[model samples]
Target: MKAIVFGSTGFIGSHTVEQLILKGHKVTAVVRSHSNVAFLQSLDVRIVEIDYSDTASIKEEIEGHEVVYNCIGSVGLRSKIDLENAVEIDLTKKLVRAASLSGANRFIQLSSIVVYDFHSSEPLDESYCIKPQYLIQQLLLKREEVVRKIGEETGITTIILRPASAIGRRDYMSFFSRLFQQHMNDQFPLLKNGETKVSLVDTRDVGRAMEWLGNYPFPKGSMNLFLLKGFDTTWKSLKEEIDYERGIEVTICDLSNIVEDPVSYTLNTFRTHRVWNDEKIRKLGFTTKYSQRESVKDAVQDFRDRERI
Candidate 1:
């Protein structure tokens, strides 16, 4: 299949492009002119630069592609200018509209599991009701709704994948990656006992899942949602993995006493034990290749290689 991956320079996007190429699919990586292409340059892909703000140009570039992977979005914990919602929703709308006009066979959207209620005691599944607690969560939910409506009306086979916190090679902005970097600098903080379980997925597995979906036989105009989780582990376990990998026992700073508005919310988010029922995709024969331990080790190695440490 001929595929075009937007935002192909970023973490998930780069991995997705790699998986697509490895699966014998011809891939065209689309990115902004100023975006870094160091990783994409290493792969056997046709890279195209375009302004995402221009729908005509997007449609022109997307014309010859059978599949359009919309991996464009902001990832991180920041509320400045409502950046998450603005970039995610606005760019998604443009991409969908262009893909519809360009006659693309399928549109794959990369969404986050954060759309589900973060504090839920039960495991989150695709059928679980979306009750986002904060500003970014609210916007992500809104983005999914927009995709559903646009897909139904435009008759595009659209798939929305809500992946857990992604970490591995090319990971920079994820929670675990930041935590690992902080740990390396001896400034990592632990919430309470650091026993809260966090659901995480490997970016490579996510890319594999996207490639599988691209070839799946779904009816045109159908909208499907799937949850992708690689493995479940606790904060303490992750920290221990880092310690063992780096060969050091670092001092843990207690954040259990901090109780305020934004600070408390951010800390409590990591503190909350979140589990995902990602069985839907797995039952369909989608298997994850990376374990929690492997993911942590790879992420650590990637960081070291990048920093030349």
Candidate 2:
């Protein structure tokens, strides 16, 4: 197998690249000029640095690859809403166009589970209609639509993977990472008494899911969407698990006292139950290696080993 991975320096992308290499696939990783490639330097893969703003360059880089995996997206607790919109909307459109033009056999897109409406108590599936609330959520919804539309028109098989909050090693700046850090510093906030449920999946599992879908046979001119979630738990349970694993009782602050920021916007997401049904992916023989408890323990230990906490 030959694959090209964009956003290879990111948390999820890095894991996917590692899994692909372990599966004995030839891999090419695309990154930006200033991206830190220290972790990827020792991997058995080719690394290409290119300006993503150049569509022609992206098209050229994507050519001759059997599979193109797009893991590019905005990260952080806070960002310029406008900048994020452009990256999720414009850059994604460009990548889809370039991949279709490059004649890739399959295009796998990394989407978010947050695209589903949060008002429902039942777990969401791939068939759920998108009702995004935040600016970032809206951007992701648009990205999914654009990819499907382009794939349908170009006769390329497109697979969309919407994974829950992915947590694992090397995820230094994700929401979960920041939450762990804040807990260590005694500054973590609890929203609505931490009653809302959140679905989570380990980055390794997410990577494996992508690898599985990459090799799965998709009928010509078809687009498939799968929701990937390992375990579902309340915010309070997640915090308790981390505390028990670390042997420390971290203080949970009042959400009302926290200042309004990007982090606050993210915390607002947890005020509602956001769980997804993984039966769709499970039917395809996808199994998660780490449960929610195991993932939390591993992530906290990784943070400690890296001296991040």
Candidate 3:
């Protein structure tokens, strides 16, 4: 199978490219000119640098690929919130239009589970209502809408994947990563005694799921959505796991005293229980390789090995 992946340099995108290659699929990794392709360069695939601002060029680049994977996203936690939201929404609109024009067999979008109204104690699935609250979550909801509309109008097969918190190597920007880093540096923040539940999925498993969906045969003009959930655990349990792995007791600070920063906002996400039911995808023969504890352990070890602590 031939696949074209946008945002190939990102955490989840990088793993997806690697998995596709390992499965003997022909991949074209689309990246920006300033992207660090050191890892991608080592892989057996075609690397294409294209101007994201030019929709025509993006369309041309995606042409002839059996599957177009949209993983492009903004790492704009530190930037102007409005600008970041605009950029994300605009890019998604362009990608959907470009993929539709390219006539790809399937368009796989890497969405987030936060789009769902996750206040309920029951697990969320594709049927859950979308009631995004945060600025970022609102933008994601809009992005998903654009893809769905375009896919329906153009008669293209669209698959939307709402993956839970992803954990593994190359996830230095994730909330869990930041929390782990703070814990290592003795500045961890304790939220409600660190008792909120979090559902985390391994990056490799996310990649495998994308690959499976990309290769799966969908009926013509089908629009499918799935939630990818990993193992579930509480923040306290995760912290204990980290403490046991690192052989040190992390200082847990009062949450109220911690200044409002990106990391703080991230930690606050667990103030509400976030869980998803992925039986829909599981029934499709998709399975995760790592448990939640193992996923967190691997992420911490990866950071340690990189000497980031």
Candidate 4:
């Protein structure tokens, strides 16, 4: 099978490309000029150049692919100008159109768990509806509509995977990654009580899940879960693990309420608004290879091994 992957140099995209090749599928990796192509070349995969933020650029590169994977997204890193939203929504709309027109077999979208409402107070499934309180979240909610419609209208097999907080090698330095790094360096601050419920997914599982789903034809569309961790990783457990794993004393504070007003607004949103119930997707055929604790240990070691901590 031949496949096309956007954001092929990104954390999730890179892993997807690796899995695709290992499964004996040919891959064409499309990425912006600024993305490092050396890594994709190292995998013996063909590389195409294009920016997903541009419609013509994407439509051109995706013209003759069997499968198109959309993994493009941002997290509070862009300017507040309206153009950012336009870029995001426009690219998604354009990609969905291009894939359908090209007679692609399947369109897989990588989305965040943030689409679930924070007030639900229960485990969320695909049926759980979300009302957007933020601009970015609203864009994803809107993109979902576009993807679902394209599938219905064109009979293209479409799938969306909402993985929560994916982590692995070369990961973007998130609070979670920072936490792991701190433990590795024995400099982890005891931020609020880690009592808040959080979900995690290994970056590796994300690639595995995508490869597994590629076989199932989805005329009606399906959304799957790829959560590798539990609902919460307590502060006590986090600290204890650091001490045991690295043989060092680490401090953990009970700043669970810091989520009320995080140092960065993005973190505040994570602490307060995001929630997901992956049980529905789990039943569909995806499973995680890493738990929160296992992931934390691996994440810490990766950081140390790379940074020489």
Note the Cα lDDT for every prediction shown.
0.84, 0.84, 0.82, 0.68
Compute each candidate's TM-score over C-alphas.
0.95, 0.91, 0.91, 0.82
Measured by TM-score, how close is model 2 to the native structure? 0.91
Q: What tens digits encode model 3's per-residue C-alpha lDDT throughout 8-89?
A: 9998899899999999999999999999998899999899999988888999999999899998865444455573448777
Q: What is the lDDT, from 0 to 100, of the residue 252 in candidate 2?
A: 83
In candidate 1, which residue ranges exceed 4 Å CA deviation?
82-85, 262-265
Better of 1 and 3 by lDDT: 1
Clashes of each: 0, 0, 0, 8
Lowest lDDT block of 10, candidate 1: 76-85
The C-alpha local distance difference test score for the whole of candidate 3 amounts to 0.82
lDDT tens digits, residue span 94-197, model 4:
88888887777889888777565555545566776667656666766777777888777877778887777776766665556666666655565444444445
Candidate 2: where are CA atoms >4 Å away? 75-77, 83-85, 256-264
List model 1 lDDT by residue over 1-309, tens digit each. 999999898888999999999999999999898988989999999999998777889899999899999887654556563744487788888888788889899899998876766557667788887666677777878788878888988999899998988888987777777788789778667786788887888888999999999999888789999999999888788788889889898888788877777543467666777889889988888999999888878888898898984
How displaced is residue 235 in candidate 4, in Å? 4.9
Q: In candidate 2, what are the lDDT values of residues 79-135, reduced to their tens digit? A: 656734466778877888888899888899998775666558677888877676676
